[model samples]
Target: MFNWKRSSVIISASVFLLTACGGGGSSSSDTNNNPTPDAELTAQQQALTDIANAVIPVLQNSNNQALSLANAIDAYCDEVAISSANVASTLATAQSTWQAAMTAWQQAEVMNFGPSFDGGNNSIRERIYSWPAKSSCFVDGALVDYDDDTAGFDINSQTPRRIGLDALEYLLYSNDLDHTCSTDSSTTSPTNGAWNIRTDADRSLARCEYAKIVANDVAAQITALLDDWQGAGDNYFQQLSTAGSTSSRYSSATEALNEISDALFYLDTEVKDMKIAEPAGISADCASTSCPETVESTYANQSLANIKANLQGFLAVLNNGMDDLLEDAGQGNIASTMTTDINAAIANIDNFGTTLVASVTGINEADCTNSTSDNRLEEACALHADVKKVTDVLKTDFVTALTLAIPQSAEGDND
Candidate 1:
């Protein structure tokens, strides 16, 4: 069911560069006086064809590790039935990555497009286009759900972020449609860049818009699964109080909780991998190879490394936030009764959130362009932390609030 969307993730990446509603963008990187260029969307389609050809061979090839990942996803799906609470957690992961990527891309895309300029995504695209190796954690889908006025997906819908990622994929891999400027021999050409800095800023703004949706709509979809976990937890306790007797019901609840954790991991992985990987895995820091003057020590000493590590530690906190998931699902043991795994996980993440905000708040924006590898890394790290803040809310803080409203079940059932 998700194949169509997944396949398209790398295909639709071209259109995001365009401005709709029949308006032309200036900031034209081209020197041409022409008001409009030939429709180059076709060139974008061709780019997708090229990426498909390149990636498909690998998909069909004989490889152990690559094949193993496919097998694992299959096994995970079978355990949770395609429609249970497990799907909630499954969507959660994708939702988080999508939220982060959109923020990053938009932060990069947020510039205004003026007339007389092609104003393509030159500033950000060029830097990332030739990059090799993708960091799966950085992949993100750009589609907006629920809160978005652009595309309003139903609360129960599970289209996945593949389509959104596809849009970005096309942009990254597609061949250039306007190399006319490159061939021109003018030494003082203003349109020599692939895309403009304004466009990059727009990309980042669009991302922020998408993050708002994940925070609201995506969270709603996961509520039911969380409800199931809490219900099952309560039921397990009630039964034990009546008698130390054990039953198969608790095991079923255990399975449901496990499924929830696994599903979240899967969806998040899907969104995170597809986009982040495309730009060649993101680094800790690099500011156009120009390390800042103040950063005189080790490469890792740059604020970017600290930012990257903290952001990574924050992601670690989210993954680790669910460590207590299975604990409450198990058979009634003494340790189980005394602990609220979900609560503890939430607390840990909340604590980390505070630290991230502190590290990010004080850094100067000028440090973003230093000569050291750490400068760029630091910029990405700080930006990453911003995304992480939103993620913490969607994945942890929001979940914590639900415990207050959801009535813990006194009896457990799979439904």
Candidate 2:
């Protein structure tokens, strides 16, 4: 989720204006027909504009991938309805499509501003791919409801927990028909006990049907999100590139640049803490040392894949124009250093050589420490440390150099 508050006081516009003028921005002249060829968008302005450009294709590709997933799910459900012998094969195709969609959306995760953050309480992104706040229990209950009252229940009207990629994962991956909720939970009680009475094939069919509905809903939401960014709705790309103009939502180009920088912080908390730390047992959330169940895409076992996609998104923003901005500000070393660290983290993740769950399991049982001789655990911990190196600069010097504020979620975080 996004933090409404910014930790540091935003730098005044006057200072930013001075910084921009001193930097390598183009200045129009009546006397000279040709301005200096070196003159161009300031690093800050360029960063802002670059993201606006990048987001369009990111959203478009994500929407296309989602549509593919929906089509695949439709075929899978069709097979299920007829008890086709090719049910498993069709289901595999759907799962593969889901993974592709997930990869595309994961890249879009870093481009989390404008339509993705504005009205409806981030419902658009949530509808497409809710995670870290999802509930299998709610999905289970919704499954029963969708199965029992097919005509009455609408997946489009469901909450994020009940209908998203996470729910689809449960439907497509988990073979278990048992409710995830406890007996005390309404989902597991007599009112919804019909879930358990069904045969395995019946449960599979119901889950597939539910998955098809959820996939369609996800595809619709992705289209809506894409339209919001495109000219069809807000034309956020223009608003972002033309920031500081009356038409743009941003009061200044600096504010627009800050928005993109703030989006990058998602790598710190979500990528570093929630995705890696909690699952690896280093973060406070995992008191037992390792909680593999909390890993993103637990059912699909795409945790490592998700992290890799997150890095790709992170680099998408950092490489866009932030590095040039740093260089113009004489902070090029910061850019080089953090880029190296980010690449190191990626290398560690790539070299881990196995699933995240398997790596966590390899940790020393006695101490729950990542220092074990097990190369997998060491490599996982190395990845965490590598990421922290990049984020450490993000929270301090990067924000200081750019005059951007630290997100409230990272305000007091020392690690």
Candidate 3:
């Protein structure tokens, strides 16, 4: 999901104190001679604990869904390998399961701190869902190499670019043997050309085996992440919730808040810039009115779904985690406004066609580059603008009120 060190740049902390800290209403005890007040539990501290509590269940559910996705992928691969009679149904089921996993993953994206961060040289996040830098050539090469010597081809040995969600997407949505390694792309090296001459059955079986291997690897990684969070004793969740304690990673509740707040910038950068603007050709990299090839999930036609999932994830962070904090800060109205704006943005996308390619193609054919007329492109643009409004509030009002740090990559990126 996150490229870790590559995309992230270190930025100095910018903390703002906008409003006075508001106190939460305390409950009175019925029968107590002299009950000691929980004076140490401040509003900020409660808010941090609330966020941690809200997040734990979501993460556990996400882990279960990841396992389910792995099972589905493995089952689909097995059917494909044996040329089963129910291959079509199995593939469809696998696609559905993948979407479910993607939804859960998106929800967890806002919490992409702490355990999700890279440890030393290991990248658990990329091992699960490497995008933008995905290399289909690596997948193609792996398939070809597997065909040559199945015993020598190990999917786990492949780099992060070749064997995550994107690789699985390539294998599941695209036809068998469709990917090819070429010399033109610098992201991946060209492999042996032997696969080009292989029989259809051979290529399909090879791809299926590779997909199975990737699924197993993904499952193991996801389970490890889950275990780190709440599977047993000495979990990260306890450290996160018990901030300021000697055992906690964070020395203060604000540090925990900053981590979650910074993670929300994924919506501002990746969702807004890469997913929406890049494909719309509004990004700096594109000159045309639209670039369908840059769109994520182009093969599956699930770009809109991805956007919806992202917004939903953002909403989850606000409602489940940040609402109480905003209320304590006497800025509950901001949360209400954000909820309304985000829901409206989602509805705008729903009004537009879900298939991004089809919508963009229609806009291109009409040559409605600058037209203000009520058309698909205009609708899409309106949705983009609406989402930008939400982002603006998040970066400015939300972060400033919460005194949260903006991610370095997202800093100064007004787009």
The per-prediction CA RMSD against the true structure, in angstroms, equals 26.5, 8.6, 9.0
Q: Worst lDDT window (10 residues) for model 1? A: 17-26
Question: TM-score: which candidate is best?
Answer: 2
Please, what is the whole-model Cα lDDT of each candidate in the order they appear? 0.27, 0.71, 0.67
Per-residue lDDT tens digits for candidate 2, residues 1-415, read 1111112222111200000001122212112323232333333345566555545666777878889999999998899999999999998999899998888888888777778876544478777777878988889888778877789887667888898888888888886877788752445434435566667777788788888888888889888887777644457766776676544588787788877777888889898888888887888888886777778878888887788777767766665567656665557678777766766666777777888887777566434454432333355565677777888899999989766899888788886
The local distance difference test score of model 2 is 0.71
Candidate 2 weakest lDDT stretch, 10 residues: 14-23
Off by over 4 Å in 2: 1-43, 120-122, 184-193, 365-377
lDDT per residue as tens, model 1, 1-415 = 0111122323331112111111111121122322132212222222222222222212122122112322333333342343455534543343334333333322121111111012233211222211122221122222222223345444223233312222233222223322112322321223222222224333333333343333333233223212322234543223211121243332322232222223233112222222211111222233333223222111112222222322332222222222122122221221122122322323343444333223333444455333122223343343433333333343443334212111122112111
- Residue 361 lDDT in model 1? 38
Cα deviation of 174 in candidate 2 (Å)? 0.5
Ranking by TM-score: 2, 3, 1
Q: Model 3, which residues run further than 4 Å from truth?
A: 1-41, 120-122, 146-156, 183-193, 362-377
Winner on lDDT (1 vs 2): 2
* Candidate 3 weakest lDDT stretch, 10 residues: 2-11
TM-score, structure 3 vs. true: 0.82
